[model samples]
Target chain A: MKKIFDFIDLNAEIQWVIVIILIILITATLTFQIWKKVKPSNLVDEMMLRTKSWWGMCFIFLFASLVHPIVTYLGLAFLSFFTLREIYTLLKLRDSDRTVLLACYLSIPFQYYFAFQGWYTMFLIFIPVFLFIIIPFLLVLSGDTTDIISSMCILPTSLMLGVFGISHLGLLISFPEMNTGNISGKALLLFLIFITEANDIMQFICGKIFGKHKILPNVSPNKTWEGFIGGVICSMIIGYFMGFLTPLETLPLILISACIAILGFMGDAIISAVKRDFGVKDMSDVIPGHGGYLDRIDSLSTTSSPFFHLIYFLLLA
Target chain B: MKKLILTLIYTVFWRSFNKIIIGLKYHNHKSLRKKKQFILIANHNSHMDTMAIMSAMPSKYIHRVHPIAASDFFGGTKLNKFLMKYLVNAILIPRKKANSDKDIDPIEVISKLLNKGRSVILYPEGSRGTPGVMSNFKKGIGYLIQKHPEIDVIPVYLDGIYKTLPKGTSIILPYNCNIIFGKKIDFHSLEIDDIVLKSEESIQKLIKRE
Candidate 1:
């Protein structure tokens, strides 16, 4: 406890950043609530409730960040469980794919276990390579070759993004703090979370205000060019100041911020496409305001892996 | 004491076991809870199907639900009868026979239960069928609804239960199984044959969602 406080005292700037972000979020919620009263719109109510849920999520995340890396890893494992559960609940799974689904769900614990051990090679290749082969073998052994093509394609795709992709956040937190006066893994995880979440919020706010051109109307109707540009710029500015949380210099931080924004946008669209294909309005109504774990962390699904790789090669290498 | 123990076993022990092995997904069209005495018919595939329905049912309705099991299969011995009567809360009726005098009619037993404001779960297919293919519903369901036209018949589709624990298999395989409840059908104006066909049709429609 004392050590955590001393670490907080040392990284007081990051502490201040969290406080400031919380204040801004609260102020935005209040302003939106008032705006909702003057002009009652369904969109405003959804946005207001979404903002409220964000406050709850942030506090939970802040507590996790303050705790040990094990807490962060377990928290992420829990997140992966919820996300995969939602995916399974909505996915059009075949009878033969049942074993494959079980294997996929079981792999969540193994993936996090690898992350806990800091077994990077196992963590990275387990789902994409090993499960990629194992899932089909299990399917074939079931002796039902019907819908094999679609099942093979969809199972691996869902497992990769839904389970393995989200597990990278836990892997990111397994990195050891270096000797060059760097922050701990929890701080880096928190930084990635803040940037990605802020980017999403900023994009929503900007799109609502000045969103005329539909970027991909078929895939994601709400995404707009104006919103995307505004969000990227704002997140870049925020990410530039957050550079102190990592060992990156000015140029790398800006580049990382841009990567998060763009890749995060792509992630959001990919999930939206899947949801649209599935004819589901939301993944599941598990969370009160946010639809599901998938809905809340769609951007993180895309951003986490690339962001981790960028930092790994640029600084850790 | 029996109802309490059965409810506990179903809720705690069977539910968790089946839930882990066969991931059950439920899609209820309307609030089936409010209807106290409707006939619940599902495509039978495994012994677990009745247990799945028992677990998914609201606890208040647990005691009221009497799943109709085969007398020969479940009531062959005194101990089996005790288990069926107590643990399963089952109404053991004889399987279909050509002679009506020797065998007690299942409709009479089911109607008696329904008149007492108790829900009865019927497997219209008589016994578990092959996993994917649904068999023709027996005329018993139509006759039950015909005799007691006031009762609403709810159709249920049980998906993937055959593969989970098919007949002649003691080992339970972990598979993704779903139980979907279709809308309640009113047989007041329909013929008995139409009632059976429509009831089968409603259940067949739910399989499409799978």
Candidate 2:
């Protein structure tokens, strides 16, 4: 692996990963096409739309990853902004909450800016600490306490998850030590993304095939114990093989992959419960088949921070 | 040159703001570009309504599209008048001068625009009202369509713009807004009252859909 990395040039791992991703997307598209021809149904049509969206997403991911780090930061920041917007829209926040909502949006750029500047202390505490107090203060300034408790709870938590949580991925790129030969922070970022997405697909496939016993019937009816276990194990295996992408050892990588898989499921379940409570099937139809930015990045939003911290403790510390 | 600047602004700034900041969505709008000259009637709730409608049009027709605005409201200040005239390309008509013989008739201005193969965006509700609630569309639209029987009338349903920039608010919040264009209705044989009622019904039906 080191020989191949040395032979190709800098960013070889990232290039190889992009190539692999493209191949996977093309395979998925071809498989969907063949499957549709063999068995045409609403399910197939939906799957085809999903695969088409994946193609678009892959192209974007490739562009953002291969381009300048500033582009990746901007893309991540915009994603955070849109997901937060989607959450705010669903919460049906009052007009009085507009100041707090704008505050929430204004915090997104600063959060990502902290990450970009490698101010880990500021990035970690910005939204959860400072904005937590300031948001409620702004809400109180409005003096409309009719549903103050709900806004108080929803605004901070949404900002924490949608903005603070996702900005960690951008922070990964700023790690100076992660830039070594063909292995850079981009590879690590892509590794986490690929594993999280793979785990989602694995769990979904396992659930459809072997999902009999419900894991959480109230929160996510489709989730099953069998699917969860199968997905984690599969992700662990994939993570072990892809351990070269990161600086971690095999055992830690496998364990961390399992943690990510479990956390991803939890993330999906949490968002699912939010949707269920709101009586919404999807967050929004921004993405053609993936529902919304929030719907697509729910798992990533949850898994990113934990993954970043684990790597930080193991390698950086 | 002013028309060119308007199209440039619409294409660059206004379109991005609508799509990115406000998250505007369109439904059944494929045929909107094919429309050469038509009257677009939509529900008014926000100051963003006219800009949103104009931004959604093809840049080729953007210079030719004029949103009819009440002079008293939009022409209150010199700055607002400049923006309404130059930026928005709106035809400001006096709402209180219906009986005045001196001023050009509001319907006549709209008819002249339509006669010259230009499109006009008319809010049948006349003014911004309660958010998410539809009031009775005034008979002005019915009268305008009656004069230009050859022009097609497209009923548009705008949802969630009020949430973004509702009445009595200058702060623009980010929200998902929808613009649904309905099929063109020909009211050649229908009575003016029927046209008014049918146009309202058409927009109301669009609101109930999804």
Candidate 2 chain A minimal-lDDT segment of 10 residues: A1-10
Question: Using lDDT as the measure, which candidate wins?
Answer: 2
Query: Runs in model 1 with CA error above 4 Å?
Result: A1-25, A59-74, A88-94, A143-150, A178-181, A279-281, A288-290, B13-49, B58-61, B70-87, B111-118, B123-139, B142-210
Model 1 docking tier (incorrect/acceptable/medium/high): incorrect
RMSD of each: 5.0, 2.2
True contacts kept of 2: 0.57
Q: How well is candidate 1 docked (DockQ)?
A: 0.14
Full-model lDDT, candidate 1 = 0.79
Against the true structure, whose TM-score is highest? 2
TM-score of chain A of 2: 0.95
What are the per-model DockQ values? 0.14, 0.75
For B1-210, candidate 1 gives per-residue lDDT tens digits of 766776688877777776654556566733677777778899987887888888777766688888999897889899999888888899998786537576687677777888898888899999887766788989888888887777778888887666666676565555446778888875545688898888888887777766
lDDT of 2 by residue, A155-225 (tens): 99998779877898998889666665544788899999999999998998899889999999888888999
